[model samples]
Target chain A: MEPTNERHLLEALASGDRRAAERLVDETYRQVFASLVRLTGGDTEAAADLTQETYRKAWKSLPSFRRRSQLTTWLYRIAYNTFLNSIRRPVLLQPIDEQQAVAIEDPDPDQAAKLQQRDVAERLRRAVIGLPEPLRFTISARFWGELAVEEIARQEQVTGAAIRKRLKLATSRLREALGEDAI
Target chain B: MTQPTDREVKSLLTEVEIPEPPADLAARIKSEIPADLSSGRFEGTDLEVFDAPRRSPSRGWLIAASLVVAVGGGLIALRQMDQFQTPAGALESGVVASEAAASDAVAPESVQYRSPVDQSLDDAELETVLVEEIQLNEPLETRSSMEAKPDDSRLQEKSTPGPDVTSADKVVVDEVTAGQAELDEVSADRDRSDRTRVDQKTVASQDLPSPATRKVERSEPAPSRGPQPKLETPSEQPQPEAPGEQQTRARQRADSTGAFEKRQAAQPPQAPATVESTAVAAPAPVRESARLEDGAADRSFAGARAGSALAGSALADSALAGSVLAGSYQQVRSALSEGRWPAPEAIRRAEIVLGFGFGGPEAESKQESASPADRFTILVDELVEILERRQATESELEHLLRRSRALATELDGQPAVEELVVWIEQIGALVESAEER
Candidate 1:
């Protein structure tokens, strides 16, 4: 969303405009849910619950929202924090057989290549989920949620260089987890 | 299988499927949010409703009344103490009492007690005590000087008081008059010397034939006698005035401008050199006593000046330190926004110390001899700390940059290492630009 439009929406929301709240939910709920989906290791139900909690907390903290960062970055931070608070144990990825069964059902001539791609992608996702906290968030926000490094940094309240270092570290770890020829 | 490259890893990560949110999710969240949606309140949680009891207005009034009583009692006790202290304190108390009595006479109902007789008796005792103290402290030489300079009407006016004046009031008046007399004498000495110089110049001009000779004589610098010129007598050479004595004389002059002018009018004019010579020869002990007073005053003045200079330097140093901190913050902010690194020098020593875990006496040597990788780690840690603390320093940044560059070369073709090297170089450029500025 454009900054000016977001600013207007924020102003409207601050004035108790219910329509503005709905509009905000419409614009950001998908990206937030997607990020949460990855963070919860493909648990759609948990992601949905966390997304609701994230928006609820956002509303409560809306008045004190300093516009130092973009609204989306702020929401991403809230979502990330919400996920961290809710889940204490390591995330468990969905079993590979389920994904394999889904891939097997696809009626395409390139089934073998697609299946191999699906396996590699699943391994990559597990490697990403296994990565350390901030690294996981940095990589997930950058690729899964499609946030810019600068935006991720803003959300993390860190410099862009730090976020980039985290990405580099996360990727290096992922490379090690999955072998050299996996790509 | 071979390890994947960074670009390949990134591509694979992006290609992973992200599950879409259920269609009802947005509608459900919107339904949960209340229509009003005002700040500090939710539909069921009203922050304004509290169980704590409200304070009563009488408690506030009681607090205010107690404060007023406490202050009033303190002032009354202070006034009572003043009545039994020094004669000046007693006199001040007496004046206040008289004023209060006069006010009470207008409002008879407010008069609490009457003690006019005791007050008058106390005033009389303080006056006698003050007179005795003044007489006991007065030097025989000063008294003799006053007797010897009978023609000095200013001294006569000061020593003798009117019949209506109390002894304590007369002493206070005498002290003020004496200070005025001293100021007048100093001014008279100054005027005489000025006249002497003018008379000498007139004599020299009359003796010289050419206008050029007169101009040349006038252009010659006068002999420096410090701030105040002293009169030289043939009987006894004039003593140099001490800095303290000069300051005191200056203070006296400032205090009695009216008295100085009155004295100047009352006294008959005489030859500048002869009159000043007689005045200087008359008092020998006075100059000695003034010199003694001046010695203490000079020491105090010097001490005060030294203290003032120290305070000024401290203020300047604090200002400089604040500017340095501000400069570091600005550099970090500008670098972050502009996609570059900040100056290394602008980084603080504390952050470097904390970042490297260099706590002991050998921390410096450890930091100096740290491996390139360790140094790079320290550098990144320091940068993060700087961002956290909103502050940065130079030597650590330089060391970090050097190590990072060396490591980047050693780990060639690594994108992360290359990026870090470029960032450090940008910081180096920023430091260089700052230095130029």
Candidate 2:
């Protein structure tokens, strides 16, 4: 779906239109904070941070809206960067070059069975957090951002085949973690 | 437990919901945004919404920079041309000829040329000049008379007694006596000529002279024996200022500026008679003392050769110090990353100091050779090491990594290199897949 007129929204806010700015703040706050919480995994301080930061960023950036992607897409990208930053891990945005694809076979043969027993919520969060960055990114774009696989493929600049492959692998891992409890 | 069916897994992951943040989050975000906006810190706003474009210079900036460099360089080259400025009158004709000769080196200057004498200035070179056909009025003089002379000198015994040898020896003796006498006459002339040269320099400065003016200059007319002149001194050698003191009075003087005008003036400048002075006053014969002077000159040249050795030693010291500091900083950074180390600034400071490295092999050599530099480095290294140890409070990072590695090894059984890589990749994909959902 085409993104809404983010530039129009920003221009209204810049001119001291409290109503317009308030409406933007109200609309974006829930999704932004939820996304942060989802990314940080129940870290309350971080969730609140991610929420405030998104709105702040949106407000500040509203005036220069060249209207490329929808304003919401930008906010999502910022939230993702913030989450990636907070985790303080490595390899957040690695691309799947051909050489990399061949290497992505399962690392451990035996751990899948045992990982199925952990608390579903915690396990899901940790597993996703521990997952390789590319797969993790694909799943997050689809879930918290509510983007379709096609939308994600377009956003991630990857082939539709690659997106599906990542999704299949991620789902299997989640299943191994959640098992019978999930359904 | 196995990999869940796609439909079931996707459904569960989709069901996973993030709770709403506190109400204050919206207010906080709202306030910070406007301040960032009106502050004019950001160039363009919502454009960054999609992506933060990498900061890079525009083509115009690069073009402007190139123009600046070109103009600046041209100006410098023009200014440097001023020192060898060609005079406006007859001097310009000679300068043009010289320039033509210079260009002639490349061929195609059409001037009828005689055999080209290589005019490149080496250590020993003299310029071309023409002299007028005037007779020099001079006479011979001598010092020792027949009364004080020894009847049979040791040098006389070594002389060949053939008829031709006697005639040749008499001619040589006569020339020697005449030359020595002329040098004596010019002893006072040396001082007077120097004053004239100085006066000429003052005159030359006022009006630019023609190129045709004779430049009958000698690179070395006077033997130098003073410390002041150095390369410009023309001729300098150490002469003992005092009998026992190490001080050698080395005096050097250049041809005073007005040398051209004075030589070209109505009174032609007199060339001093060449005198090979063999009468070195001495108390006792010391072969080593003469060698000592030669050795001093050798030492001056040796200083040039020794330059690289000294620089190499310094580089090695710096590298050694650098590695030591780098090792320490890396340890500290790893510590900081894991939260086992505190005080990032202090660690950063320590790293900066440590970066130069403590006393390694290079430092040790430097310690011996350049003690002051090495000592300063050593003190800083010691300080960094002390600070690093203190700031790196907890020591569990290594242990944690070991545990992580061990668990990783046990879980995966440390497959073959390629297999292990594949497994890591697959696990990575799984992990990433989970995160995405």
Among these predicted structures, which one has the highest lDDT? 1
Tens digits of per-residue lDDT, candidate 2, A59-174, equal 55566655554556567767787777756633432335997877888687687753343245556766776678888877777776666676667667788888989988877766
lDDT of the candidates, in the order given: 0.52, 0.41
Q: Candidate 1 — which residues are off by over 4 angstroms? A: A89-116, A180-183, B40-437
Candidate 1 C-alpha lDDT tens digits along A1-183:
899999999899888898998999999999899888866666788899889878877877888898888888888888887887776533422344776877776677668987788778767877877788889888888887778999888878899999999999999999998994354
Local error of candidate 2 at A4, Å? Answer: 4.6
TM-score of each: 0.33, 0.34
TM value for model 2: 0.34
- Root-mean-square deviation of candidate 1: 33.0
Q: How many collisions per candidate?
A: 13, 31
Per-residue accuracy of model 2 over B1-437 as CA lDDT, tens digit each: 55567785566566655665786777675555453443323333533543456746777788889999999999977754532231111122333344334333421111111111111111111111000000010111111221012222522432324434444445444543554453343323433443444344335423322222211111122211111121211122232111111110100000001111111222223311111132111100111221222232233234444444422332233233323323444554333233233343545443333222211112234236633223333333433443445422122323322333333233221111112122122223333334457
